[model samples]
Target chain A: MATTACFMIVSRNDIPIYEAEVGTAPKKEDAAHQHQFILHAALDIVQDLAWTTSAMFLKAIDRFNDLAVSVYFIHTRLMLLHDSRNDDGIKTFFQEVHELYIKILLNPLYLPGSRITSSQFDTKVRALARKYL
Target chain B: MAPVAPRSGDVIFASVERVNAELFTLTYGAIVRQLITDLEEVEEVNKQLDQMGYNIGIRLIDEFLAKSNVSRCVDFKETAEVIAKVGFKMFLGVTASVTNWDAEGTCCSLILEDNPLVDFVELPDTCQGLYYCNILSGVVRGALEMVSMKTEVTWLRDMLRGDDAFELQVKLLKQVPEEYPYKDDE
Candidate 1:
């Protein structure tokens, strides 16, 4: 498990649909903003690198000092920033959340390429974070 | 020979020829998107989707009966169960649970935790009033009507609207008795 981790689901239209800060360590006031800033900053690199290869899981693509940014690609981009390095756990987390994302998408009322505001999706993602992250 | 027993939903679904889940999901998403663009109103889009489903249901019921080999269901309770159990399975490849029945057994909720229809959907604020799955209800109503059972179907719980599961309340409004072993039109 990572001492600290931030996860986000970036939609196809380049917006964060769902986000969660799942770190065991107590969070600082500026931590979430910094984490989000770092994650967004790495998107250009991730996107550029992702286009070159079809591989979905690109582990530790960028590092911001002590924290590392990892990413997994499906129709949407699943990105994570964490202090601890646990490749297997993060991959499992992405895969499981992807399944949940699919469930969210199948809802006819839910429009694709929109923000995922479902609290149920939020709760499940957090629970998965606790179990995996 | 006696009527062949209705095949289980699981068996029929497994045998059905279908495309990959992603293709099906994307195609539906495309249709809904096109409707929203063309209709320019969430309510209108919803109504059109329901109408489309109703049309499909009236025609699709025959395929459902033939494929599942379900005999005529006399009671509403039995009908709801078969729909939740077998109809949903053969068509969508997922089984739904029947719950929240009233004392009269004329109404019940079809709870679906998993269905192929809901995947990759997120509702915007403007589309809040939309019943995205309203088509399912229309389909149910239209199909039931064909069997001489006038019914009303509605969404009691919508996962897209932040509920736990998709719950459809199917209420029997009236039942029309069929004239059995009848003569053909002259």
Candidate 2:
């Protein structure tokens, strides 16, 4: 079984900028929609917790059975859903994603709170996931 | 002791950090295309770009302050110098020459010899009045506003619009005094 399941990047406005599934688990017909609902549901918890804590990395904020979600909040919220219990590895993943997000922000053309549709950005994210996830 | 000569803007920017010019140019092109498609009006595009730049500038100022570690400017002249030498160099990897100071010294122009955002860009003749580089001016205005220096920034010349040089004019309107909202009334 793959340790990592799904990765998603949600903008501050609660829009999903990017989403990818890294696990080898067989596809479920409703899995994509299910993941989207779960991700949005977790966001409320993230916002409530954000006020009390100043940490960028919020480890294991929510879970459903074996599935767990880890969040990193900078200008946007980067969430990772996985089956494995590697706390340290998930932190590294979020860190790398945050770096790429900053690079995207540096682009004069790119706007904050917009969908990230750059193919180059997508490719880089996948490469990072393959390396670390 | 006599004050040491200030380093030239070019000298300070000589070894400044750099990013991929192609990435910058391509991303800018994509953004322009998207704006045109969505707005469908040349004038509207210009306004949107300026608004976007203002938002970016407000956030970017934080990064600039953290990285440059420079103190607040004593005056508008010094502010212009810092924007040209330090602000532009640190973020854009380019230095603009500050020139054409008005008689009052509250207004000046920044001459950009090379603009990475306009590399390989050609403005359509139909959009003659559009300020392709208006975002730069917006950034200046937005950044200055944050420092309590309310200023007006406009593009005096644009290479994309067939101008000989890229020039941005900045005019100081007034400085906004900081207000403490929670102070008790005497």
Q: Please name the candidate that would achieve the greatest DockQ relative to the true structure.
A: 1
User: Candidate 2 chain B, which ten residues in sequence have the lowest lDDT sum?
Assistant: B1-10
Query: Candidate 1 lDDT, tens digit per residue, B107-150?
Result: 99999998566676777677788787787888888888889989
- Candidate 2 has an interface RMSD (Å) of 8.4
The 10-residue segment of model 1 chain B with minimum total lDDT is B1-10
TM-score of every candidate: 0.64, 0.54
Displacement of the residue A49 alpha carbon in candidate 1, Å: 6.0
- Candidate 2 C-alpha lDDT tens digits along B1-186: 444424334454555566687887777778877887789899999999999899988888887776565776678998898898788877777788899998999999999998888765555445667787778878888898888889999898888666888999999999899876686774
Best of the candidates, lDDT: 1
- lDDT score for candidate 2 against the true structure: 0.79
The DockQ-derived docking category for candidate 1 is acceptable
Runs in model 2 deviating more than 4 A are: A1-133, B1-18
* Per-model root-mean-square deviation over C-alphas: 5.4, 14.9
